[model samples]
Target: MKLILVVVLTTAIAAIGITLSLILSQRQAARDRALSIISGNKLQDATGKPSDKNDPNKRRAALARKLKESEQEEKDDKKKKEKGKSTMRELIQQAGFDFPVSYYYILSIVSAAAFTIGAFSLGFPRIVIAMISIIGFFGFPRLVLFLLTKRRQKKFLEDFADALEAMMRLLKAGMPMNEAVKMCAKEFEGPIGEEMSRIYELQKIGTPLGEAAVLVAKRMPIPEMRMFATGLLIQQQTGSSLSDILGNLAKVIRSRFQLKRKVKALSAEAKSSAGIIAAMPPLVALGLNTFNPGYIDIIFETRSGHIGLACFGLWMFTGMVIMWKMSNFKV
Candidate 1:
C-alpha cells in the first residue's frame, strides 16, 4: 500500500513539475522573441502612417481632446458597477462558448460523481468524501470556466491589434466604419472575427457604430478593446479620422504587449525561486513518508493530524496567493 501510494504521489509531482517547466520555457522563448523584435524595430508614429487628413496635427489634437472627454464618461459609467461579478452566462459568453448554463450544472454533477467515486475507492471517511464532492461540484468547474474565459480574452488580445490595423486599411480605402467592421468580421478568424461579426450584426439591426463597439468592449472588458470602443465613440461624436485613431491605438496595444513580455522575462528568476520554495514542503513530506511511513501515517489516521494537515494546506494556499498577487503586474 505504501509503495503504491508513493508511486502515485511521485507521478503527480513529476507531472506538475513537467507542466511548470514547459510553461516557463515557453514564456522564456516568447520573451526572447519580443525582446528581439523590440531591439530590431522602432515604434511607428501615428502621424507617419497613411492618413487622408491634410492637417494631421490638428486632427490628432482634436481627437486627443475628444478622447479625454470619452475617458471621463467611461470612468463615470464604470464606477457604478466596477466591483460587480459577472454572471455565469456572461462568463460563458466572454469565453466565446455557445453552451447553455445547464451544461455547467451537468459538468459539475459529473465531476462530483467522479470525485465521490474516487474518494470512496480510496477508502476516505464519509465526511471527507462529501467535502471532496462539494469541491468537485462547486469549485473545480467554476475554476475551469474562469480559466477558459481568461484564455479566450488573451487570445482575443493577441489578434486584436491586427484586427484594428485591418480596419484602418479598410477605412482608408473609403469604406464607412460599419462596413470596415463588417469586412474585418469576414477577414479575421477566432475571437476577433466572432466579435466583429457580432458588432456588424448589431449595426445591421440599426445600432450605431459606437454603440456596437461599446457592446463588444463590454463583452471583452480588456483595456485594448475598451480603447477601441472609446476611439469609435470619440470619432462618432467629433468626426475625427477613424483610420488614424485606430492606427495609433494598435501601436499603443503592441507597445503594451511588448512591455508585458519584458516584465515577464525580468520576473522569471523570482517565479522560479517561488516555485522551488512552494515545492519544498511537499517534497520533504513525500521523502519522509517514503522512508518512514509510520511518521506520516498519523496525518492520515488521526483527527489532530488531519486538522494540522488542513491548516498547513490552508496556509500554503494563502502564501501562494500572496506571492502570486505580488508578482502579478497588471500591464
Candidate 2:
C-alpha cells in the first residue's frame, strides 16, 4: 500500500508540472507574438515577391505603409463627421421657426379643434363654449409652450456646466478647441452637447467659427451659452489660449449652477405654497362632489347658479395665473 501511494503522488506531481510548463510556454509565445507585431517584424506570406521573403526591412516598410493608410482613414472619418454635422445645422436653419413657436402653433391648433368638438358635442352654452375655444386656441397653448421651453432650458443649463468642465479637461489634455468640443458632444447626452456638436460640424464646413457660435447661441437662446460662445469667438479671432478661456468658462458656469441651485432651494417653499393654493380649490370641490353630490348639485340647478359658477371659474383661473407668475423665477 505504501509503494502504491508513493507512485500515485509522483504521477500527480509530474502531471501538475507539465500543465504549468505548458501554460508558461503559451504565455511566452503570446508575448513574443505581440512584440513581433509591435516591432513590425511580422510579415504576410510572400507568394509574389521572392526578395520580400525573410526580409525584415521589407516587413518594416510594409508595416509603415499600413500605419500611414490607417492614419489617412482616421483623417477621412473626421472629415466625414464634420460634414454630417454641417448638414444637420443647415437642416435646422432651413426649418425656419424656433422650437417654441413650432410647438405652440401645433398645440394651439390641436387644442382649438378638440375644444370645438367637445363644445358642440356637449351642447354647452354658446358664451361658455366660445370662451373655452378662445382660451384653448390663444392662451393655453402659449402657456404650455412657455412652460415646456422653460423646463427644457433649465435642463440644458444644468447639463451645460458639466459639459464645460469636460471640455476644460480635454483642453488641458492637449486637444484642440474643436476636438475638445467634439469630444464633449460625443461624451455627453442631450441638448447642450447636441448644440455643441452642431457648431463643431458647422466649423468644419467653412462656416466662420464666430458665425457658428452665434448660430448655436441663437438656437439655445440662453445668456450663459451666448457668453461662452462669444468668448470662444473672441479667443479664436485674437489668438488667445483656448485652454485657459475654457477653464475659466467652466468655473463660471459651475458657479452659476451653484447659485441657481441655491435660488431654487430658497424658492422651494414659496413654489409649494403656490401649487397647494392653486390645487386646493379644485380638489376640495371634487371631494365635496364625491361625498355630497346633492349639496354640490344646487350650484348647477339654477340659471343664476350657472352664471356664478362661470364667474367663479374665471376668478379661479386668474388667481392660479397670478400665483404661477409669482412663483416663476428666472435663473
lDDT of 2 at 307: 59
Q: In candidate 2, what are the lDDT values of residues 1-331, reduced to their tens digit?
A: 5664575556556655655665566656644543353353222333543243535565455445544543574477468767764433332332333444455467778998898889879999989899989988988755655666566677788888788778778877888778877888898777776788898999899897767877776566665775576556555544445665666666666776797788878878988998888789879989998998777787789765775676566556656555554555444
What ranges in model 1 sit over 4 Å off?
1-86, 296-315
What are the RMSD figures for all models against the true structure? 10.1, 28.1
Candidate 1 lDDT by residue in tens digits, 1-331: 5664575566556656655775576666744653343233222246665345424454455556755665685576566447544466667788788788889789999999999999999999999999999999999988888898888888888888899899899889899888888888898898999999999999999999888888887678786786677667756755556787788889978888888889899888888888898999999999998998788888889876776676577557656655665576666
What are the lDDT figures for the candidates, one per model? 0.76, 0.66
Best by lDDT: 1
Give candidate 2 misplaced runs (Cα > 4 Å).
1-108, 278-328
Number of backbone-clashing residue pairs for each candidate, in the order shown: 0, 0
**TM-score of model 1 vs. true structure:** 0.72
Q: Give all TM-scores, in the order shown.
A: 0.72, 0.55
